[model samples]
Structures are given as C-alpha cells and as structure tokens.
Target: MTELTDRYVWAAVRTVPEPQRSDLEPEIRELIEETVEAHLASGEEPSAAERAALVQLGDPERLAADYADRSLTLIGPRYYLAWMRLLKTLLATVVPIVTAVVFLAQFLGQGEVGAAIGGAVATALSVTVHVGFWTTLVFAILERAGATDAGLEWTPEGLPALPDHSRHGRLPDLVASLVFLGVLAGAVLWQQVRSVVRADDGSVIPLLDPALWSFWLPWFLALIVLEAGFAVRLYLRDWSWAAAVVNLCLALAFAVPAVLLWSEGRLLNPAFLDAVGWDPAAATGGGWTVASIITAVVVLIAAWDVVDGFLKARRASAPVPRHPVLVDH
Candidate 1:
C-alpha cells in the first residue's frame, strides 16, 4: 500500500521468473501487510511500521532467490575461497616455471630471441586459461553436488589463525623494499655504462661479465621484479603460509644461479679483475678465498631470507592469548 512497500514488492517479484512472479507478488504483499499491521498494533506510526516491516523481511533480491529456488553464485560460498586460493597458488608457482622452461627450450632449440619470447608468452596464456577453467569447473561441481559429506566439512580446527596485528607489514617497509630493488636493478645496469676500473688501453671495464647480459642478468632482474611484487602483496595482506612458501622459492631462485656462477668464476668480469691488478692466484689464494667467501655469503643470505619468511608467517598467524579476569572476593 505504501510507496516503500510497493517498491520493495516490485523489486522482489521482478527478479523471480515469470509465472512464479504472479504467485509471489500477492503472497509477498500479504506478508508485508501482516507485518505492518502487527507493528501498527504495537503503536508504531504507519511510515515507521511499513519501513520496519520491509527491514524485517531482509534483502528483497535474496528473498526472491529463495522463492525462485535459485542459486546466486556459480561456485557458492562453500568452496569459493578454496577455489581462489588454489588458483592463485597454481598460477604463481606452476605458470612461471612452465613459462621459464618453455622459453629456455624454445630459445635453445631455435636460437631465435623473438620466437622464444612469443612462444613462452603464448604458452603461459594458454596454461593460465586451462588452469582457471579447470579450477572453476571443479569447484562448481563440488558446490552443486553439496559435497559437505565428501570430506569437505568445515571445523573449528580448520579455521585460519588470526594474524598478529602488531607484526603486520607496514607501508614504509613496502616502500623501502621497492626502493632497494630499484637501486639494485639500477646498480646492475649502471655498471655496464660506468665502471671504476679500466683496461690497459684506458677503456672502462664492467664489474660483471658481459656474457651475463644475454641471460643471467635479465633473469636476475626478472626475479627482482617478482620480489618487488611479493613485497607489495605482503604489504597489502597479512602473512600466510602460501606467502612464506613463495618467499622461500624466490630466495632459492635468486641464490641458486648466483652461487653456481660465482663458484664457476662466471659472475665477475675477468677483464676487470686483470685491470685492477689483483691476481686470484696470489699467495693468499686470493681468488679461491674470495670465491669461498662470496659463496658462503650468498648461501647464508638465502638461508636467512627463507627462515625469516617462515618466522614472520608463524608470528603473524599466532593466536592472541585470552587472559582470565580476576575479581576481588
């Protein structure tokens, strides 16, 4: 009868399919009228009674969904978060490794830069599509089947632990991480153009091997970009087990190659060392000693980084303690 009630009734029934709407409209109107009458009997004003009646009925669209026996979600609430978590984990872990492998294979087989890059990109996109489609389909099936009895039942023990609010990543930490990554990238590129050392002919010599420019340096830079993205993600959200695993993987990605190359004496430019007049074969066993030191530093740093990630995640996920209140007797 009132404008608010009329509008709510129309909104609700309009969403219900055709013939059902005809039956639902009058039934809904009757229910609202009954509620409004009850409120009026309680001494409420007509406008206030009608508004309270509509509020009591809750969201019209949800009511319509119930009347129509319709599901509003594709995957439903039961499996939605699980689906999202699995999808992200697959995309982040499997996709990158697949892309890198494809790129390496294509580049090695064809010896073509552009072709390798294009193929890798295409493969990555295809993999992403398949991953998303399959993941969504599985969750949808589980939702429609009402797979609660299929070992998918939730429990209090299964609930995610709350993060420690005080230990959460700060914006300043993100900024500092991004800045550090930028500086690292800049320093790597800068060494190519300007160097502190020079050859006998007075030509500037880069600190790192020019050979690394073809693959190693670029790959390292890409890992740095991934690290930056991880930092931003950490800043935006609380630390999780997934994030800690990602951090560990990133540390390995960065350190593994660097250690291998440095051990093989492929990391630093030989020309630069010669120009500096520092013989590795000196009495102090300078080259071996320096190489050992660098290797130890790289390994230790990577280990520390991985450990730190796990510790942070553990600390963040630790539950708050509930202390008992004491009353004086």
Candidate 2:
C-alpha cells in the first residue's frame, strides 16, 4: 500500500473509536514500516523517497478530520456573526408579527393601544430573552455530554432533532415562556402600584391610603415573587432566547432606578415636589433604597445564573481528545 493509504487508514482509526487510542500508536508505526518496505521494493529513488512518503502521508489533522463527519466542528468561531445576525432578523420579524396580532386582538378585549403596544414589547422581550436563552443553554449541555462519546456515530437518546440540541429543550422553553408571563404580571402589578401610590405630582403620600396600599402590597409582593420565579427558571433552565436580555432588562430595571435615585443624590425632583405642594425634605427618600435593595437581590441571583449557564456552555464546547483507554478507565 502507498504511504498515503496507510496514513489514511491510521488517521481514520485514530480519529474514531477513541477507546482504541492506546492501540493506535503501534498500529500506525507498523503500517508506516510496511508501506516503506513496499516502496523500497518498487526501487523508488532514495533521495526522492522521503519527500514522496511525507507527501503521501498527508497532514495528520486533515486526515483525522476526514475520519468523522465533523459536523460539530464545521461551524467554528466565524459563524458567531452570522448567528447574531440571524437572531436580529428573527427579532425584527417577530416585532411586526406581534404588532399585527396586537392590532387585531385590540378589537376583542385588548387594552389601550398604548398599553397593548407596551405589553407586546414587554412580552417580546421576555420570550426572546428567556425562551431563546433556555434553548441555547440546554443545547450546550447536551453538546458537552455528546463530547464524551468517542464513537463517530453514537446516537444520543432524547437529543433534539435540530442541530446541536436535545429534545429536552421543549420543556425548558415552556418554562421560560411561563417566566416571561410572570414578568408581565409583575409589570402589571407595578403599574397598578404606581397609579395608586403616586399622585399626578409623582410624590409619595404619608397618610395611610388603605385601599391603595392594600392593592399595592399584594401586587408588589407578586412582582418580587414573579421575579424570583423567572430568576430561578433562568438559573435552572437552558439559556434559550435572549434569556440574558430579560436579564438585561431585569438588571436595568434595578440599575437605572438606583442610579437615578442615588447618583443624583436627589430624593425627589425639586420642581415636581414644589408643583404638588409637597416638601422634598419631608418625603421619605427610602423609596430608592427599597428599589435598590430589590434590584440588588434580583441582579445578584440573575447574574449567578448567567455565569453558571455560560460556564456549562463552555465545558460543553471545550476541545475533546479521543483516547482508546478512556472506555475502560
């Protein structure tokens, strides 16, 4: 056999059936000697012989790659741009679809057009962030698990039909969708709280407003509960959609207010307080403090999930070495 042919065989064997790794070195060396002997019998000139042999052997990496289908490694790092662009396109496309749906649904029982628009934006944000994140996260985990398989053609049970994912993604996506709904509920509750607590002047009232506070308390607690649920979902589920984006919003929700409240060191806007005849000094500046605390807790939990999810994904994609001994060891 030509030295090239031996290289091809050895490369294929070495690339796959990793449990055979320990055996491959000897087998490859033997193949090399046998091929060289046959070449010498042909009386190929010695000076040109080594060059021909090296050429025939080909590149090791190239040969190893040929043994397996290599669909996994095909995408590579450059595809990240294409990946981001595709999602952006999907989001842009989704926007119009959601708009049309909101417009049509408005006739049935949809709230104000403005509210409908805002709700759609919020829901889209939630689904895109959460569902997509969970999907990606689950796929990543399965992909990592798949790396353990040395056989070129081992079938992973319960793996999703889509490229690079497990079927288990469906459940995670559903849960994320629920989490988005929960966020929507929280926003609604917060909105109610704002309406009841803040006057047109946007200042807090000191006197007990039972009816308002009663409504506000349940809704406020509900928002916190919902955020906790969504955070937990993200922490546990796959990084499906822009799960990070929902997280981004959650982060901003806390960050922006905290900055606005504390950064300026102004509890209430002086002009706003004066117009409402409320003294800014008398007002409890604790609202920002409360919001900041809420945001801090939420951000902390969400950030941990983000970190954990990414680390899991990284482990999934890390370079996997094939070895024959691993099967037994």
Top of the candidates by TM-score: 1
lDDT of 2: 0.51
Give all TM-scores, in the order shown: 0.45, 0.24
Which run of 10 residues does model 1 get worst, by summed lDDT?
320-329
lDDT of each: 0.82, 0.51
Candidate 2 regions exceeding 4 Å error are 1-165, 189-292, 319-329
Leading candidate by lDDT: 1
Candidate 2, 19-49: lDDT as tens digits: 7656655665565566566666789875356
| Residue pairs with backbone atoms closer than 3 Å in model 1 (clashes) | none
